[model samples]
Target: MRIIGLLLLTGSLTMGLAACGGGDEQSTAKQEKAVETSTEAKAGVEEFTITAKNWNFSSDKEIVVKKGEKVKLNLVNKEGLHTIKNDELGIDLTADKPAEFMADKTGEYVLKCSTVCGATQDHEGMEISLKVVD
Candidate 1:
C-alpha cells in the first residue's frame, strides 16, 4: 500500500508540471502574436514633419501622399507659434500636438494658418496644400 501511494503522488506531480508548462507555452505564443500585429500596424503608417516658421511652413508647400494610407504629421515650430487647419480633411495641427489620419480622399486640400501672427500679408500667405493622390 505504501508503494502504491508513492507512485500515485509522483504521477500527479508529473501531470501538474506538464499542465503548467503547457500554459506557459500558450502564453508565449500569444505574446509573440501580439508583437507581430504591432509591427504590421506600424509598417503601414507614414510619418511626416511640417516645420512652421515666422510667416510660412518651411517644409514642402505641397505635401503629397497616397490615398488609403495612414499618415502622421508632426508640427515643429521653428520661429513662431502657429496652427494649421483643414476643414475638409479634418486636420487641426498645433505646435504642441500632431495630426494623424488616414488619407481616404484623393484631392487637394488647403491647409491654412488658424492663428493670427504678424501682419495681414504674413498670415495670408501662411497656407499649404495637402495633396492626396491614388
Candidate 2:
C-alpha cells in the first residue's frame, strides 16, 4: 500500500504544477493588458488651465511638463484685457482666448503678461515659470 500512496502523491504534485503554470500564463497576459492601458492613457492629450483674476494672472506659478509631450493650455481671464505670452518659447495667450503649446525642449521658461493692462508690477507685472523635463 506504500507504493499506492506514493503514486497518488506524485500524481497530485504533477497536477498542481500544471495548474500553477496555467495561472502564471494568465497573470502574465493580464499584466501586459494593464501596461498597454496605462500607456494609452498617458499618450492621450493632457490639459492645464490658467485663470486670470483682477489685473494679473491668478496663481501665476511654475508649471512643469515632460519633454515630447503634448499640452493643452486653457487661459481663462475674468478681466477683459489680459494676455499671456512666453515669447522665448513661442507661446502666446491672447485676450479672451486660450493658448496652446507643446514642450519640445527640457528647460525652464518664464511666462509673462504681454498686454500692458495696468502697472507692469504687482499683479500686472506678474510672471510664471515652467519647467520641461525628459
Candidate 3:
C-alpha cells in the first residue's frame, strides 16, 4: 500500500513538472503568429457595396471594375438567400454576407446568382453580369 501511494505521488509530481517546463511557449508563439496573420489579411483588401431586391439589381447594369484591384462586393439581400458565381472570370460571391473578389484580369464578365430561389423562366429575383475593365 505504501509503494502504491509513493508511485502515485511520484507520477503526479512528474506530470506537474513536465507541464510547468515552458512547453506553452511554442503555443504562445503560434497564437502570436495567428494574430499577425489576421491583421495582415484585413489590411490587404478593398471594398465595394451592391444591393439586390425584388426582380432587379439596384443598378440595372453590371459593375465596372479595374483589373488587379481588390473588390469587396458587398451584397445586401432585401429578401431571400441570393448567391453570385462566375468561375471563369473569377467571381464567386454569396449574398448572405458581403462577398469579396479580386479583379485579376481585364475583360467583360458575367456574374450570376448561383442560388435558384424562385422561377427560372425570366430569372426573376436574380442578378447577372458584371463587367471588368482594364
Best by TM-score: 1
Superpose all Cα atoms of candidate 3 onto the true structure and report the RMSD in Å to 1 decimal: 12.2
Candidate ranking under lDDT, highest first, comes to: 1, 2, 3
Q: Where does model 3 exceed 4 Å of error?
A: 1-46, 59-62
In candidate 3, what are the lDDT values of residues 75-120, reduced to their tens digit? Answer: 5555556667778855666544555677887777666767776788
**lDDT value, candidate 1, whole model:** 0.77
**Poorly placed runs, candidate 2 (over 4 Å):** 1-43, 59-62
lDDT of each: 0.77, 0.66, 0.62
lDDT of 1 by residue, 42-129 (tens): 7777666677788878553347889999886667666678999988888898855768899999998888889998899989899877
Clashes of each: 0, 0, 0
Per-residue lDDT over 85-133 for candidate 2, one digit per residue giving the tens place of the 0 to 100 score: 8876778875335466678989998777776766656545566667889
Ranking by TM-score: 1, 2, 3
Q: TM per model?
A: 0.65, 0.57, 0.54
Give candidate 1 misplaced runs (Cα > 4 Å).
Answer: 1-41, 60-62
